[model samples]
Target: MMQLKWEKEGYIVSDDKTLLQMGKIEAWISGAYWAAGRSREIIEKSIQHSLCFGMYDKDGRQIGFARVITDQAVFSWIMDVIIDQEFRGKGLGKKLVECIISHPDIVHTKMGLATKDAHGLYRQFDFEMDECMRRPLL
Candidate 1:
């Protein structure tokens, strides 16, 4: 698959795996409310398989991350979006989402995500809450 990238004011959003900081990403998601206790192996495997976006500051440090599990034609589930604590209020998260949803490979696919408190942010991009049913296997 072709990698996608976007840049603004020295910050870059890209699907390039070489730009991903695995340690930082594992640290963030492993401590996140949704995936607390997740293992490094699991995180690594997920990143290896998913379409991922990494946001880097001008200094080339990874500051934000998002991933989409998709077939590139029909369905996508956005997951693990996070911005570094110091970078939270600068709209980097929004840029990350935009880069994911607007990518040509999956832009027209049906996209979905679950968030406890980011409804307002997703709403700005026209995402609506929908009733969903789940069956836990564990």
Candidate 2:
């Protein structure tokens, strides 16, 4: 996997290994969902099956992430994206999605993601609801 590095407001993503940055990642997801009156099961599942990316402070503190789930052949689901409570209202979320959509594993496949409120942000990448994609890679 390629190292995660992208620049955002008041932060610069680094070569942080997001899977190992579990505390921050968990905080990001758990807090975001709870504020929306949802559950952390989404965060737990994200840790298990998603390619997670962390946005870091200049000092390397993780502040944000988004996850992608894919078979590396047919479909990639961009899911459960969140930035820290201290770090919203900027375009950081968009940057995170762009990074995942452009990741080496996910870019080549058709992408699918479910969002309840961020349709405008995702539409920038042409993401829309579709059938659960089904097929085999050749």
Candidate 3:
């Protein structure tokens, strides 16, 4: 399991699935525009298949989350990044993403993500807009 700590702030970013709080994760994604109406079953399945990251404060309460679908070699697509409402604007989201991209398993892969309005955030990590296309399954 990969773990990174912000010693000064007592915040941790880890890839330990056992530390993930499913209810909180489901609620966060269910409320997001891109994943609104997503079922808990689907969320669980996605987390099972993806490399997951969970962020927690000193008290071990989950406050943010993200996941990556990757081959761990060539490509990594980051998804479901959210910072708990109360923790927003504190730079925790940025730190979560930093830990994800810097993880040894996927750091060298080309990273990608689709965001409705977080272009600025992703740009800070050197993710650039590209001519890419996607197809919505019927």
Cα RMSD to the true fold for all candidates: 0.9, 5.5, 1.4
- Which regions of candidate 3 fall more than 4 Å away from where they truly are? 1-8
Winner on lDDT between 1 and 2 is 1
lDDT of 2 at 112: 78
The C-alpha lDDT values of all candidates are: 0.92, 0.69, 0.91
Give the better candidate number (1 or 3) by TM-score. 1
The reply for model 2, stretches above 4 Å from the true place, is 7-10, 14-20, 34-48, 131-138
Q: Model 1, which residues run further than 4 Å from truth? A: none
Candidate 2, residues 1-138, lDDT tens digits: the string is: 566666756666543443347766655565564335335565666567767677777777677776677788898777667788787887887787778877776689988766668889989988876766656636
Q: What is the TM-score of candidate 3?
A: 0.95
Q: For model 1, how does the per-residue alpha-carbon lDDT over 1-138 read when each residue is reduced to its tens digit?
A: 778989898899999998899999999999999999999999999999999999999999999999999998889999999999999988888888989989988999999999998998899899999998888858
**Per-model tally of clashing residue pairs:** 0, 0, 0
Higher-scoring candidate on TM-score, 1 or 2: 1
Pairs clashing within candidate 1: none
- Per lDDT, the best of the predicted structures is 1
* TM-score for each of the candidates: 0.97, 0.74, 0.95
Worst 10-residue lDDT window for candidate 3 reads 1-10
lDDT of 1: 0.92
lDDT (10s digit) by residue, model 3, range 1-138: 445444337898889889999999999999999999999999999999999999998999999999999998899999999999999999998899889989988999999999989999999999899989988869
State in Å the error of residue 53, model 2: 0.6
